[model samples]
Target: MAEFLQFAFSGLTVGAVYALVALGFTLIYNASDVVNFAQGDFVMIGGMSTVFLYATGVPLPLAAIIAILTAVIVGLLLHRLAIEPARGASPVTLIIITIGASMFIRGVAQIVFDKQFHQLPAFSGDRPIEILGATLLPQSLWVLGGGLAVFVALWLFLERTLIGKAVLATAANRLGARLVGINTAVILAIAFGVSASIGALAGVLATPITLTRFDLGTIMTLKGFAAAMLGGMGSPLGAVVGGLLLGLIEAFGAGYISSVYKDGFSFIAILVVLFVMPRGLFGGRSVERV
Candidate 1:
């Protein structure tokens, strides 16, 4: 039971980060119909920037805020420079552009941050709390709490705010939204900025536990993409559930099977989901008239 509890706690900790990443994907996908592969780069930017800034004598809290802002700026630039210009392009073209953007961001990050793995000092401390012979790091609590808080805040923003409704309208139908006086271009830009912020927050919260480097976002992108697909690409709630489920699968697989193949399990999950349920667990069915 203790062993199980240990794995469960570990799963939830990492799952929270995956959930944040998945949320970023969902947000951008809904608003722009573009899957920002660079989502994970935002995470890397957040973590690496915080580490670099803190090392240069900046306070940790302030450094994190600055890092998030930096990602938001990058996101806005991505939209203005790349996405906006290519607005009428095909979906595949837009996807390739995002891929190129991801590569560009990674190359820039490598130049800016160097090729070193870095970790932040835990927000709380190094002490671990014991429960039923299982130990839980205080940082885990921060990750979990942060993820939940972001979700609730996002829900409120979407449900109660006028701008949020505009975003929703734009997502539902771009032409219709434009007819209704919603500035879809602005909504798309906001989506990118907000998504980048969420990704950065995930990096800030998870970096202490996962350690980070310039290339860290690559694998995180794949994992987060898988989580998004598993939960239904455009569904926010599905993103969270898929992320947590993927994390739990990884934890249990590593605990019971083999740690070496832990990453493989996520790929396997992706394959299974693709073959068995292409629409994802929570994805809605689509119908087309011939």
Candidate 2:
């Protein structure tokens, strides 16, 4: 029972990061109907950039701010360069371009950060707290809280603000949004900024626990994509649940099953889910529509 609780604790901590990354996917998908494969690099940028800043003697808060801002800039540029021009192209073209962007970012990161693994100082020290037989680090609480905060902020933004409504309107009907004078171009830029910032924030929070490397984003992106797909591509709520579910599966799989196969374990279940449900738990019946 203790081990199970421990597993849950670890899963939730890591799951928080996954959920945030997944939320990034949802944001871009909802706004532009594009899956930014380079999204994971935003997380990498946050961790790597912050680590470098801290190494250069910058304060942690300042480092975090710069890191997240950098991610937003990168995301905006990727959209302007790779995605925007290819808007009239086929979906396959968009996917390839983003994938290329992802590779380019990874290569640049390796050259810049030298493929080293790095961790940040915990926000409130490294002490562990006991909760119902489970021990968790103070940083984990921050990560979890940060994830929840992002979700709530996104929910409120989408559900309340006029800009948020414009974004939704563009997603629902680009022609209609254009007719109504919504600047879809600007909204796409904002979506990229918000999505990348969220991914970067996740990196900042989870770096202490998972550690950070240039290559880390690839797997994190894949896992996040899986979680987003598992929930429903465009559903923010689904991202959270799917991430938590994946984390729990990985935890128990590592414990009772085999740690070696723990990563692959999620895929086995994903395949099963794909076969059984096709669309996913939160996903609509079909994904053909915009």
Candidate 3:
């Protein structure tokens, strides 16, 4: 039971990070129907930029904020330079563009930050706290809290704000939204900014635990994409649920099964879920009107 709790706690910590990444995916997908494959690079940027700045004597908190802001800037640049220029292109074309962008970002990161793995100090000390016969890292609590905070704040923003409703309207029916005077281009830009910020926060929170590397973005992208697919792409709540489920599966699989193949678990789960429900757990069935 103690061991189970230990794994559960660890899973939640990591799952929260995945949820944030998945949220990024959902936000971008809903806003533009374009999957930004480079989404994971935002997380990478947050961690690497923070590490570089912190080493130069910046306070940790300030460095983190700067890192997130930097990612937001990069996201805006991506939209303006790549996505916006290629607007009205097929989704497949846009996806390829994002893949190219991800590689470009990774190559530049390798040059700027090198291949060395880096980490930040935990917001609090590195001490572990006992809970129900299990030990939990203080950093884990930070990660979990940060994830919950993002979700709640995002829910409030989308549910209560007029601009948020505009975004939602755009997502639901682009032509209708345009007719209603919603600036869809602006909404798309904001979606990218918000997604990048969330991804960066995930990276910042998880850096102390998972460390950061130039190549880490690919794996994060895959895991986050899986979580989003599992929950149903374009659904924020589904992203959280799918991420937590994926995390728990990985934790228990690693604990009871083999740690070496732990990463494979998500793929297996993905296949299983796809086989059972092609649209995913929370995905809705399509309806056609003739």
Report per-prediction Cα RMSD to one decimal: 1.5, 1.9, 1.2
List model 3 lDDT by residue over 7-108, tens digit each: 999989889999999989988898888888998999899999999999999999999999999999999989989999998888899999999999999999
**TM-score against native, each model:** 0.96, 0.95, 0.97
Error of 1 at 250 (Å): 0.6
Q: Which parts of model 3 have CA positions greater than 4 angstroms off?
A: 285-290
Give the worst 10-residue stretch by lDDT in candidate 2: 281-290
Q: By TM-score, how accurate is candidate 2? A: 0.95
Can you rank all candidates by lDDT, best first?
1, 3, 2
lDDT of 2 by residue, 1-290 (tens): 77889998888888888899999999988887778788788999999999999999999999999999999999999989888887667657887798899999999999988877898889999879987887999998999999999999998888899998888888888999999999888998899999999999999999988899998888888999988888878888988888878888888888888999988888887788778877676876555644
Residue range 235-286, candidate 1, lDDT tens digits: 8888888899889889999999999999999779878987888889888666
Candidate 2's displacement at residue 278, Å, is 2.4
Model 3 error, position 11 (Å) = 1.0
